[model samples]
Target chain A: MIEIKGLVVRYKTVEFKFDDYKFKKNMISIISGRNGTGKTTLLKSLSSLIEYEGNIKVNGEITYNSQEPILFNRSTYENIVYPLRIRNLDLNLYKEKIDKYTRVLSIDHLLNENALKLSSGEKMKVSIIRSIIFNPDIVLLDEPTTHLDLESIVELTTLIKELKNELTFIIVSHNSSFVEELKDEEYRLGGNHVYS
Target chain B: MIIESTMKAVELLFSFDSEIYTIIFLSLAISLLATATASFFGTILGILISISDFKLKRFTKKIVFTFMGIPPVVMGLVVLLLITGPFDGMNLLFTKSAMYIAQTLLVLPIIVGNIIISSEKTQKKILETATTLGANKYHKITLLIKEIKPFILMSVILGFSRALSEVGAVMLVGGNIKNDTRVMTTYIALNNSMGEYSMSIAMGIILLLIAFVLHTLLARFRGDFYD
Candidate 1:
């Protein structure tokens, strides 16, 4: 479970004060706003990548996947297994999961290719797989669908929906269809969140 | 006259002369050693400078970047003073060790400066990514180094290039002693001064070839990684 109280992010002179929100575990929530509204800033703040004034109560470890993910100068396999490798986790434990997810995302062929050469959409897919493979507690994805095509986006939406039972997600995206399809709740940065 | 000398230079290149080969081999060994040593320390220092936040950061960077342009003669003088002064009884002047010391100093700044600049550009993003992925301090540093290895290799190559062309420092500290400390650059200078144009040209050609081969190797390394 993750709860935010009086979350405020200030960059230079512009300030963003997000409404208080409580996001439950084993669910997908969406944070949406227009440009300059600090949507990504909120995600970064949650990840502790930037400084902010707020209380973010999270139950477990977290992973933040950037909108434009940084792929190392290595193969996609290396990039995908990075989060696990760094945690000193047994990569063999996740081999089956990696294969399953790569097939779902249709990036199985790209696993051995140089990651830097992948198309933008392919890179985003790689980033998504890398992020979720380690099965962190809270995953914050900032505009992850920006480079993804419609079919890829649908595939991702399904993947997130399927994984939401095990991993909590706070996604910042403007893809209305994706948000409508995957979100169990929605939080507007400058406004309030609606929980059905 | 120039063409005649070039012809003679070509002839001498394949002559299998022991002296020429000896000087070539000595230069390659010493420069490789100096570059390797400088790279090891320079890259560590560079990574430290990039990751550390201190009050004197700006000032320290200014000084280091300034040293990147330090003249070989100036470095030679500094090493000369160090050896001839406080360590007078060391009898270190005009030896291969002195030349090695001088060349290391000459190449250190180049390696450090290049690494510092490249690391500064990539460290923040790489570290941020690693942190988000739950890496500890040791893991973050290791990942950063692994990711920026190409840039580190480039710094090493730059250091080697600087060491390969070095003449002033080696000439001063090495005394260009034949069969002892004579290297390609110093050997060329010595031969050129003695009207041995063919020998100088032969060394020059070999020097250029080494540079080309190293650059091609770097290109291949970078290409393999960058798609």
Candidate 2:
């Protein structure tokens, strides 16, 4: 479960005001807004990427994947293993889970290839797989399906649905259909809300 | 006359004279060492400057940016005076160590400035993601460093090229001592004074070749970076 109360963000000439909100455990919440409406900024602020004034009470760990996928020069396998390594989990313990996710994402073949050489769709898949490998309490994804093809997008939506039982998913996207397919609740920002 | 001089320069290079090789080797070694040290430290400082919110951060960046345009001769003169006057007891003036110090100072600003630009460009997103993930300060820094590895490598190469080709500051500090402080640029100067035009031209060609090799390596690395 997560609770965000009175979040305020100010970035050079722009201000974002987020009111108190609560997210239920193991539920998918989608935030929909047009471009320049502070959707990405709000998502990042929720992820703790931006400095904001708020009280975010998260019961467990949170994992965040950015809108633009970030990949190192290493192979896909190594990229997926980064967070696991940071958490100090034994690699052998998660080998089966990693293998399953890679195969499900159709990235098993690209595991040995340098991640920087992958296409945008492939990189996004890898980034998503990396974010969820360790089963964090909450997972924040910003436009994860933007670069994906129709088939890949469907597959990802299915995967998110399957994993929703174990993790809270907060997604920020402009694709309303995709959000409708996954989220039980939705919120739209940037229409007459300001903080005094 | 030009053709004859060029031919003689080629001959001197092929001959591999001990004095000429010594100068070439020393220049490459010292410049590479200085660049390596400066780039390592400068990248860390640049990342710190990019991420941290502090008073004087803007002023510090402005000072470093201004230092990037310092003339090599003026930088040389400053180091020379400092070593010979205020800290004269150390007697670093006209020494290889003094040359290293000057070259380090000359290239540090470039390294720091390049890294600052690169770090600022990418650090915001990485920091945001890491923070949202509840990553501590150490994790944030490590992840950021990984993200900017390619730019950091570029900065190091730039610093290396700048230090390797420098002549004025090194000449002022090293004093072009035979068999000791003589580096490629200073040796070229010495050979010219002795009317060994062939030797000077040979060293110049070698310097050009080294520069070419350095750039080629950097280009290859950049290709890998983008891939």
Candidate 3:
């Protein structure tokens, strides 16, 4: 569970004041807002990526997946296991998880290739796998479906559904279909305020 | 006349002069040592500048960039004054250590500036990624350092090149003493002033060769930094 109050993010002349609310655990919450609204900023603030004034109480570890997702200048296999490597987890133990994820995403053949060379959609898939392979408690995804294709989107939705029981997901996306299919509830940002 | 100098220079090279070899070795040693020290500090400072924000950050960056353009002669004079002024009691003037100090100053700005420029675009993005991956302080630094390794290596090479080719400051602080503080650049300057064109040309050839070898060796370690 994540709770926030009096959350404010200021950039130059712009400001985003969020409502006090509790984001439930073990659920998919989609933050939806118009272009100028602070949907991404709110998500980033939750991930602690942005400086905010309010208090945030989180129940477990969180991982953020950026919209475009910058991969390290390394092979796809290496990029997938980065979080694990950082946590000092043994690579051999996660071999099956890696294989399963790559196979499900149809990226098994490109594992040895440089991740930066992959197409945008493939890169997005790689980023998705990397963010969740280590099993963090909460995953914050910013516009995750932007570069994904229809088929990839379905695969990702299924992947998230399978993992929904184990973790909470806070996502910001303009893709209505993807959000409609996966979102348990929508938190709409009305310009600088919360409407939901 | 050029062809005559070239031929004589070639012959002098095969003559295996110990004096010439000593100058070459000393030149390499001084530049390598200076580059190493300057790069160590420059990289740390570069990372700090890229990652941290303070009131004086813009001013500090301006100072670093300004120092990058300091002329070799001016640097040499400043180093000379430093040793002979407040540090006079230490008696470090006209020593190899003095030359090292001068060369380190000469290259420090270049290394820092290059790193600051090269890592500027990627630093924030990479740091953000590391943060999301649950990196601790040590992990973040190590990840950032790894990402910037190629640029750091490039800075080191550039610093070494500047140090190796500089004559004014090294001569000023080293005193260009024969068999003691003499380096290739100073030796070339001294020997050229004495009208010994053959050895000067030989020294130039050796200097060019050293640069070529250094580039070839270090270029292999740059990884995919170009991409």
Best by DockQ: 3
The alpha-carbon interface RMSD of model 1 comes to 0.9
**Candidates sorted by lDDT, best first:** 3, 1, 2
Q: Comparing 2 and 3 by DockQ, which wins?
A: 3
**Candidate 1 share of real interface contacts:** 0.84
Error of 2 at A147 (Å): 1.9
What DockQ number belongs to candidate 1? Answer: 0.76
The DockQ score of candidate 3 comes to: 0.76
In the range A41-72, model 1's lDDT, one tens digit per residue, is 88888888898887988789899999998888
Interface RMSD over true interface Cα atoms for each candidate: 0.9, 2.5, 0.8
Model 2 whole-model lDDT (C-alpha atoms)? 0.85
Top lDDT prediction, candidate number = 3
Candidate 1 regions exceeding 4 Å error are A191-196
Q: Model 3 compared with the native: what TM-score?
A: 0.92
Candidate 3: segments with Cα more than 4 A from true spot: A193-196, B214-223
Q: Name the better of 1 and 2 by TM-score.
A: 1
Model 1 lDDT, residue A133, Cα: 90
